[model samples]
Target: MDVSSTLVFAGIILVLLWLFSVNNSSKHRLPPGPRALPLIGNLPQIDSNAPFKSITKFSETYGPVVTLYVGRQRTVALFGYDVVKEALVDQGDDFTGREQLPFMLKATRGYGLGISNGERWRQLRRFTLTTLRDFGMGRKGMEEWIQEESQHLEAHIRSLKGQPFEPTFLLGCTVSNVICCLVFGERFNYEDKQFLRLLNIFTEFIRFNTSTMGQLYAIFPWFIERLPGHHHTVFAQMDEVREFIKKKIQEHKETLEPNSPRDYIDCFLIRMNQEKDNPSTEFIYDNLVSTVMNLFFAGTETTSTTMRYALSALIKYPEIQEKMRQEIDTVIGQNRCPNMEDRKSLPFTDAVIHEVQRFLDIVPFSVPRYTLKDISFRGYTIPKGTTILPMLHSVLREEKQWASPWSFKPEHFLDQNGNFKKNPAFLPFSAGKRNCVGESLARMELFLFLVSLLQHFTFSCSEGPDSINLVPEYSGFANMPRMHDIIATPR
Candidate 1:
């Protein structure tokens, strides 16, 4: 053979050998998953249309811990309670980090508690827990706040005067007001223009984050950052929320009486000053803004959406609604607003709320986490820095955990004696170190507001031949019910 021909032949052999070695190496390290084409990974498999349901399908085929590639990065998706619990709790410290998406990094500058991990996460999380406790989250003082807000919510609903109205705005007002009381030390009137704008921004941001575009941004942040899309709108809304929080912080700073901390912002400003000289302190204006935003983001939407579903379920099943109404009337009289303390005495009400959370599963797949170090789970080695998407929806619907996993049966939360029974699978607030910090507050709000509303009004579907659709329409980051009107008749 000629010299040129021999050279080309040797090059071809070397290239083939390298490709073979690379493919074999990937087979050993990567978890079993459906085949994917180059560059796209399993993006085609994802019904960008309904990613949550699509991921659930993948779980069924690939087992609880399925690995998928988004662009060049591979992520481990843990479905079901056993796998999710094992990764999030058993190896908690090893998987506590968060993936830094471009928009979030730009918005938070790597300061917020929700996405920040390691030392920053430790300090901020500890301080937040302590502050919330001091503010009476699980105590009587916070319960009083919830009770007051519940009354406000009930009064607003009563103003509907048996008209067929959508409960979205009222529920949003009630949930947002609870956070407002916590952060700003007061509640906003239902008609407050500024508060309404903030709520609108929040709703938009949530919708954007749960869209296919949001997933694309997370995967290809560099490319998405420069492009104009809903992702940009999300970033803009984030800035608006942050600026509003900053203005509130400034107002608090100017009116500061150091000895007396009035609200979350007041307490945070005091901490920032106290830790001003500490180089490692995560307490600052940026962190404060992000923390307040986090509270608003986490607290408002999830609770309100759950309440919306709860009421919709009640409207669909008038029998359950009447039963719940009777339970409320019998347990707590209608003379005054229902209190958090009344939850224990009202088992059916509590069970109904719990069932709503479980069945709706607002956050189908929670905010994703990253493995901080090499960890082994169920005979699979999850490498450090690998993203973990825990399918919380699977846990909420796990057959092993509940008898009727797919139904809206309140009996799942009620024992044979007709008392509220705590199920280990009821992990709507999630579990482990990253378990919801505002869980107690959320519970108090849901219980007090739901029971209070029921006390004042009995929700029913408006006069229509079509029945209320219980199926949820996927939106942003929550599984929200389709827009429907309810007739809130006075009980």
Candidate 2:
């Protein structure tokens, strides 16, 4: 058939598909939402730049649980604290299926832990958690790793000689090194050219994923893949990352010692051999490569971005910075590097760090979850294959949850007695069984790196506190803080 004939034929099929969807949706009692167009459903109603904010506005009309669409994909978004909690936490298993995002599917070639479900997800996640724990993920050995990295970070800053510099890459290197030690079994020098290139790829991947082009690719993969755009560069860089991981795996294979697993890669290699006899096993080379990609990318960007944003928070609030410094000095003192043991004694500093994560609600929309089978939630029957978004931004900023939900107040994580208190609503790593696998590691890095920085330096900017905006530079995939050139004067 010619192009025009194919176009006409495709149009007829789309009309039929949309009609079938509308009819089935009613029969399934899908949640109520705004009216949608045939092919492009609710995409027109959303702000392409920041879809979550636009979706939040939809909650104003449709109440808490509502159905919407991006193109032909039917999506149910759970808003507010109670409803989100009901689905993600209270009814966790039913909603545990991870959506294979088009971009991620392309990056991982539909392999790996980050986007896998069913037996694959269970096997990888279980093995990953167990191996990470064995390697001191949240324990004293991990604390020592961070404490040593803390000194390296401090030295890098001191070399700046109080001159103004953007903390994005430096913080990226610091946080990336901690994860590197866990995964690769060694840390790269701060000045290494190749190490910096890898971190830069992580940042670019994040930036592209949040860009308009990224959303376009996710919603219309077939068309976007054919056309020339920024998405192409992203995939290329991702391939470069994959190649790097593959090379590292080869080297680890040469130096393999099953009795003494050096890091995550070594442990995974050992597991791969143990499961080599089983046909149903998920511990294979493809998984090792992709899972490492997942760990490296997720491990590097999220924590490092949080660290960079943490500094932006301090730069914006010098008083808060000084207060944290005082707490660090009083508790841990300036003579030694800050450790996890010092957290309880440094309540105010701890509160400030928690507040920073909350105020800058990174990953505003948790990674999308899908319904693997027909499921009923909140008296509504949602059919299988529907997408679910438990909007973390809504939960974090829910009016009923915090006294000043929109403000950057450290007291949100503090008590009347001035001790650090935990808030169930503070979910930067998200919640439930499918929550961040690197939560403990990220926490340790945040505490040690921030405390160490606060201990040695009093951060400020020439533009003054009034100039620093707590709002993110980008608002989609992640809430990235605005980068600023600030001076870190040694205390």
Candidate 3:
């Protein structure tokens, strides 16, 4: 209680912290990587523009598991299927923590399902999956929603009358509408100004996250957030979406039914009331809003971007697209709407869709994981608090698994008999516990949307198939396919 006693206690705490850091740093045999400088720490060595390639090249030299320092943060990079699988699958328990990413932390304020760890994460993730499933995410009811949405998409595209138009917002509107139906309990019109603005904001948020500035913000957030930039704009834009979610939550509270919850928000509100008397419940206002934002933010752009990328792929490879159409036509014909059941019957179409996802490698740097404690991986110890990149780009493009890892090949998912085959390394949704919860929904969306589009129209670009580039226009957090204007000739 005395001044000297207080000073002595503080001294012991600092000493313990110092000793912990020193012991972890000096004793642990870290994975081999480029040596770091004092403060910069390998930032100079990493290619900011195409960091994933730089990482892949680094893995080639340093082996599958490599250590790198982005800013002062000590991070481990896992490359290839064996190393990534070994950590994410075999060592799943040791690698379940999601780092409090500064960008996401700023947006969600560490309240959402995505940015949470431990108890909060477990609770939110369990509740989110159950709530979403109950509302027909990846179920027959949801398939009906997507099927109806596909008809709207067909009409929207057909209204273009075989003329050229950018499919970015079209894909976004269509995709966001599905999540809207699930979360908000209603779909927004494709031409709604507010809805379009929200979609644009989501698109902008993703673009910023995939830019050099976005990576810089992640590394130096304190400085980045202070300076004038689009990060502020992105945050403000996110506020609009959050405010919109809040408004929906209020509406749900006004008319929520106990037994018949309509959507994700409604179910969450109902559960919040159920857990109101419980002291340890995670069902509060902050978690509700953030979790809804998590689902809406995640469910929208990733699948839409992948769908847009598939359009590019289809445009690039007309023969493959045409063949897929033949398979679709044979399976369901142009009149009937495609469903999840149709996925099996239409093997070639399924193969093409899978190939598009595999080739796109959307989230190249799977949201970085954190070590729960000092964990040993492949004879190397990743220190606690270290950011871990499982490098999904490596898994999706690992040469050991895929025959042609670099090329866009539907045969990658096809057997010699042309039946759809599943490869263990096709990990666009990633693997293990923290793998995408919306995997089933995204898969269903890709199949139903793409099949429906191909059923009605033939996709083509003014520049022709030769001009269609499959390479991503940007690559940092996500590998966004280059945007293109294409015409759809109604079949």
RMSD of 2: 1.2
lDDT of 3 by residue, 110-228 (tens): 79798898888899899888878888888999999999999999999989899899999999999999988888889988899999999899889888988999999989998787899
For model 1, the stretches where C-alpha displacement exceeds 4 angstroms are 1-28, 101-103, 463-466
TM-score, prediction 3: 0.95
* Per-prediction TM-score to the true structure, in the order listed: 0.92, 0.98, 0.95
Give lDDT for model 2. 0.89
lDDT of residue 177 for candidate 1? 84
The number of the candidate with the highest TM-score is 2
lDDT of 2 by residue, 1-491 (tens): 99999999999999899989888888898888999999899998998778899999989998899899889899999888788778878999998999989999999988999999999999999999998888899999999998898899889899999999998888888888887888899999989998888889888888888888888888889988999988898899999999999999999999999999999999999988998999999999999999999999998888888888888888888788888887787787889877788899988989998988888889888899999999999889988999999899998899899999988999998999999999888777878889999999999889988888888888888889889887787877778778888899998
Q: What lDDT is obtained when candidate 1 is compared to the true structure?
A: 0.80
In order of lDDT, best first, we have 2, 3, 1
lDDT of each: 0.80, 0.89, 0.88
TM-score ranking from best candidate downward: 2, 3, 1
Error of 3 at 319 (Å): 0.6
**What C-alpha RMSD separates each model from the true structure?**
4.9, 1.2, 4.8
